[model samples]
Target: MATIPAKYFIALVPEGKIQEEATALKEEMKNLFNLKYALKSPAHITIKMPFEWNENKEDKLIYKLQKFLAGIGVFDLKFRDFDRFGRRVIFVDVLPSATLQSLQESLGKFCKLELNLINELSDRAFHPHLTISFKDVKPKNFDLYWKHIQSKHFNADYQVRDVALLKRMEGRWKVIHRFPLTEA
Candidate 1:
């Protein structure tokens, strides 16, 4: 018998009202732009790009992440304004912070060295944004979508105290585990 592979990614997810607001924005994108892809996953800022792993080794991944997160301290993150990656994607902009960058870089390196995992986006520069929609955006509607979102200001900040591990199942991403960030 052969085991099926599992897909996973790590991210920082906001809680309380911030999460509610982000989800509302995503819903608006779906209703206004007819883009449903963004609704598949909860609002989040990606810390690690999606990667594949053996199902049988899932416990090992969780164990290492637990240890790794024990050393990570809480950091403040702010999402302010709207931005796009070219014409295909729209997202809420995350203010640049050294703490966020260091955490991402450290997590990336740790994944590569300790877990022997290499993500597809690992080579590219990390641009952390909570996506509203991606390639599903129609070319003709790009401007309308951007203009609509850009005109409407969005700003929120929250302390990031945990990183979530999401797994894909039934065509939706589910938060399967959360690793608590140690107090600074």
Candidate 2:
């Protein structure tokens, strides 16, 4: 059987206040980029890029992730402004704080322990953005999407209790397990 690749991502999903604002932005995306390509609810700040793995190997991957995360603890994240990449994507920009940076660093080390030490590029240094839009978007709709998102600013703060192991199943992504960060 053809298998899907899995990834490990740590994120702070908008809980109370941020969820409300993200909902509104999602609605706007429905009109702007078309709902099919945009990400679903519970918008968040990603800690690591999606890691690739096969379904048959998922069990080992999960165990590796669990052990790696055991040494780390929870952290806080703050969301700030709406920004777009060219005209294809929209997101909530996170004010890169020292705490967030440290979390990313720690997660990177954990990933290296679990998997191969992939070369992380300088430009790919975690900037901490909450995705709000996506690809296959039209140029004409950029202004319309921007107007709807410009005035909307969400500064919701949330705690990062866990990291998720996600797989691209069917035609979309789904979480296989969420590993809580705990004391080593």
Candidate 3:
């Protein structure tokens, strides 16, 4: 018998008004550009890129995350406008904040030390943004979509109180566990 691998990533999910606006933008993008891939998951700023592990090891991984997050304090996250990774991708830009950067660094270290997961991309540096369209975007339509949204305005501010563990099941990613950051 073959066993399935468990895929997971850590992210800060936007809430309240921010979430609503993000969702609306995603819908518009899907309709206008036929970019349905972006709708697979809720809007979120990724803290750690996706990694695979044995399904049996999930409990241990979550335990380590809970302990690590317990000592952190909540901070603010703000999104000002839209940006892109060249022409292939478009995303909501997250303004740089010291607190958010520190949290990401701390999480990366903890994952390396405790979970034994060395995320090379996150370790080198952090570029925090919420993706609106990716992967399935066609090169032929990239310029058209990019030009339409490049100067569009979007703004939202929300508290970064919890980091969620999203797992891929079937073909879509879903939030399986959420670890709240407490005032420490």
Candidate topping TM-score: 1
Residue 140, candidate 1: C-alpha displacement in angstroms:
1.8
Q: What C-alpha lDDT, on a 0 to 100 scale, does residue 182 get in candidate 2?
A: 69
The C-alpha local distance difference test score for the whole of candidate 1 amounts to 0.87
lDDT-superior candidate, 1 or 2: 1
Instruction: Write one digit per residue (lDDT tens) for candidate 2, span 2-75.
Output: 78655444455545666667766776777655754545425666666666667577777778768776877777
**Candidate 3: pairs in clash:** none
What TM-score does candidate 3 reach? 0.92
Q: Which scores higher on lDDT, 2 or 3?
A: 3
The segments of candidate 2 whose C-alpha lies over 4 angstroms from its true place after superposition are 1-20, 32-35, 40-42, 120-123
Candidate 3 ranges beyond 4 A from true positions: 1-4
CA lDDT of each candidate?
0.87, 0.67, 0.85
Tens-place lDDT per residue, model 3, 53-153, is 77887887889889888888889878889988876778999999999888888888887888888868655568899888998888888988888787578
The Cα RMSD of model 3 versus the native structure comes to: 1.9
The candidate 2 region of ten consecutive residues with least summed lDDT is 6-15
Measured with C-alpha atoms, the lDDT of residue 119 in candidate 2 is 35
Order of models, best lDDT first: 1, 3, 2
Q: Which has the greatest lDDT?
A: 1
